[model samples]
Target: MTRVFITDDHTMVRRGLRTLLEELSGFTFVGEAGDGATLLAQLHHQQVDLLLLDISMPRLDGYSALVSIKKEWPELKVCVLTMHEEPYFIRKMLQVGADGYLIKNCPREEIVKALETLAEGKQYYPAEVSQLIMQDLVNGTPKVPLTRREKEVLKLLVMEKTTAEIAEDLNLSTHTVDSHRKNMLQKLECKTTVGLIIYALEHGLG
Candidate 1:
């Protein structure tokens, strides 16, 4: 059986994960932790084949925890399950040695697939993540000439920030923000916000 551990701050989220993991075949729920400190401490005494980690935690955030865990337990497989879908976050986690990256909103089957892939000693990047990589490969170099401000807007869009929120944060008028967005769309040949987001991810601009 694959001995898996979970680390999430919320009790309910942990419980839900435990329940779902238990129902899956060939998986043994070894333990869980509410924070990164507890997880690091418990890992010293436990034999975990896989770790399902959340990015936002109370004591220690996922990035720090991942670095420490990878340093100490280099052979351990970590799968990041988080609500963050930004390209930057995804790239950072993979660079930190996470074996898999799955958005929290991904379907339940994807969770099982990720675990199984990890158990088989293979890396798993969800469809969304893979799409970014493929786009980068196909584009070769980012040909579309984008201004600095336009790039910032694209990054914010990839992070799911609304136009008004981005405008306020960037201290730009709403009309100006809209103009930038429209210009980016035209330059990138994208018809929607999602396409712009994909372009940003493809170029690792976010």
Candidate 2:
């Protein structure tokens, strides 16, 4: 079971999340806090696997809290559960190490799915959030420029294609595809395929 903690300013929101977790089979609502400071304090005593955090809060905001959390507990999975859908907020949270991003108004099923995805050691950004990131990327520039072939490989990667499949589609050898993947990983400074996917999606390369 995934041990979950919630940090949101609203009492109703916390209660609602707790209720949801109680009804879910694979999740355990371990604890909650009204603000980031209290949440940080409680984390030291809790064995939490996942954190559902809100962006706007009293005392310490989510952004600062996220940075601190990641610095101290880099293995802990954090999902931003907020009403903020702006590109800036989404990008900021992802850059600061959010494992998932979900709007507060999203359906309950989506929340459960996001949690499950994180539990499986994968990142989750809802379709809307991804669209916003893509739009922002279109208006900006990539941090590290990618070659044309690299962009093609990345686009296929974002489509969830395997390396062999990508090679088949691009009429390249699997060895060549692997080489491209490695080069992209090095150039983008991504440690894993998922990180490469996130970076490519955020930079419009995908």
Tell me, by lDDT, which candidate is best: 2
CA lDDT scores, all candidates in order: 0.88, 0.90
lDDT by residue for model 1 (1-206), tens: 98999999988888988999889899999999988999999999999999999988888889889999999999999999999897767766776798999988888888888999999988899888988767767875346678999998888988899989999989998899899999887566588988999889989998
Question: Number of clashes in every candidate structure?
Answer: 0, 0
> 1-206 in candidate 2: lDDT tens per residue?
99999999999999999999999888999999999999999999999999999989999889889999999999999999999886657777887899999999999999989988999889899998778678767877335667889889889999999989999999999999999999887566577989989987787776
C-alpha TM-score for every candidate: 0.66, 0.66
Q: Candidate 1: which stretches are off by over 4 Å?
A: 135-206
lDDT of 1: 0.88
In candidate 1, what residue range of length 10 has the lowest lDDT sum?
135-144
